[model samples]
Target: MTFALVRVRRGDLRLDLESFARYAGVHPDLVRRLVALGLLEPVRERGEWWFGADQLAELARIERLRRGCDLNYAAIGLVLDLLDRIAELEAELRTVRRSRPPTGGAPWTRTDSR
Candidate 1:
């Protein structure tokens, strides 16, 4: 529900494929593999890929899921999709709750018929 904002230095807003891989401390092949698997999405210009802060964060998240949960890439994709859906649902729920009128009692009251 909470997110941390990262500040990008001047001229560091976007990175080329090599720079992205170096910044992420991973092999270029790995990055390419992730892109192939649709795990990481980067902008392709001409014949090269350009990565932004979002890709970096997503790469870190993917690594964490892979290492922490010991899941394969396919399974990780599923987990990521589910997690994204959950986050969307949570946000919708919060918005709905905020717009709702407050009731200073139980959510439901039972009525008995004689």
Candidate 2:
């Protein structure tokens, strides 16, 4: 699997609920709703919720899907399920190919002299 490395600006490195809401261009209640829906996870530190660069990126993706597409949460869930199945099938195909014998014919044995 491939992972992306995000570089956060100085002030954007760590965010509380308010900062995360402002940075993600959404309302705090909406952010809370996303958290409730398992779309975003917040870090708990010293009695405060914190968000990182990855969380910001995930929020952006969710927002884009919400704005750019007509998919509701249930539809998004179905799409994610299909994508996961595709990944599993691809992995299985790779494993099956690796376990198969070579397509070339077997080497010929020496025949009796004439």
Candidate 3:
């Protein structure tokens, strides 16, 4: 799929590309490559790329995938996309649970008599 996985955190301040790379503990060149690869999207402002403060989490996630799983950029992109989908599904499940009326009895009782 050629889908772009983007998650902008609400109320986060923006930083220029260099500043973002510094804060993310990665080289600016690496960030640029990731952006170009469609793995990350930063705003272009006055010849500079601007990123959200929330991208810190994303940077860390990318690093984690690289280090822990030894995944390349392409694989990281797919894994992150799947992770985002899982998060969205969990949020929807929580909303559905909240909207449902509470039952007097428990959801279910465990049966271990056997």
Candidate 4:
């Protein structure tokens, strides 16, 4: 997959709901449902609702999981949880490997000098 870099405001980024919906290739009403489910955070401006890039990214993830894994929202949540746990474990494994010493520096000897 390709990734793009975009700049946003210092404190937070905001996009109109229409823009966010288009980015996610979903209907505005469906986006509203996701927002209602507490999975997305809405930005308010004079009673208007906007969404952030982070929220868009999350929706994209959910969409991918739904289409690729054929999972419902509940199942998606569980899969995300397990994937997060796996990532954490992988990170820990990397840290442990980095902290260990190399084992092939010296030649092996068969002498018993105890």
Which candidate leads in lDDT?
1
Supply the global lDDT for candidate 1: 0.84
In order of TM-score, best first, we have 1, 3, 4, 2
Question: 40-86 in candidate 1: lDDT tens per residue?
Answer: 98877678688988899999999999999999998999999999999
Worst 10 residues of 3 by lDDT: 1-10
Q: Could you tell me how far off, in angstroms, the CA of residue 46 lies in candidate 2 after the best superposition?
A: 2.7
Mark the regions of model 4 whose C-alpha exceeds 4 Å error after superposition. 1-8, 42-49, 105-114
Model 2: per-residue Cα lDDT over 2-98, one tens digit each: 2222335665566788877887778889888888877788877778778887898878777777778877765655665676699999999999989
lDDT of 4 by residue, 1-114 (tens): 222222356877676777677767788898888777666778676787777777878888888999998988777777777887999999999999799886544435535442
- CA lDDT, every model vs. true structure: 0.84, 0.74, 0.79, 0.75
List the candidates ranked by lDDT, beginning with the highest. 1, 3, 4, 2
- Model 3, range 1-114, lDDT digits (tens) per residue? 121223446665777777777777789899988997788888875686778755767788888999999999999999999999999999999999899887555646635432
At residue 19, candidate 3 shows an lDDT of 74
TM-score of each: 0.83, 0.58, 0.75, 0.66
Candidate 1: residue pairs that collide: none
Better candidate by lDDT, 1 or 3: 1
Best of the candidates, TM-score: 1
> Model 2: how large is the Cα RMSD against the reference?
9.6
What are the clashing pairs of model 2? none
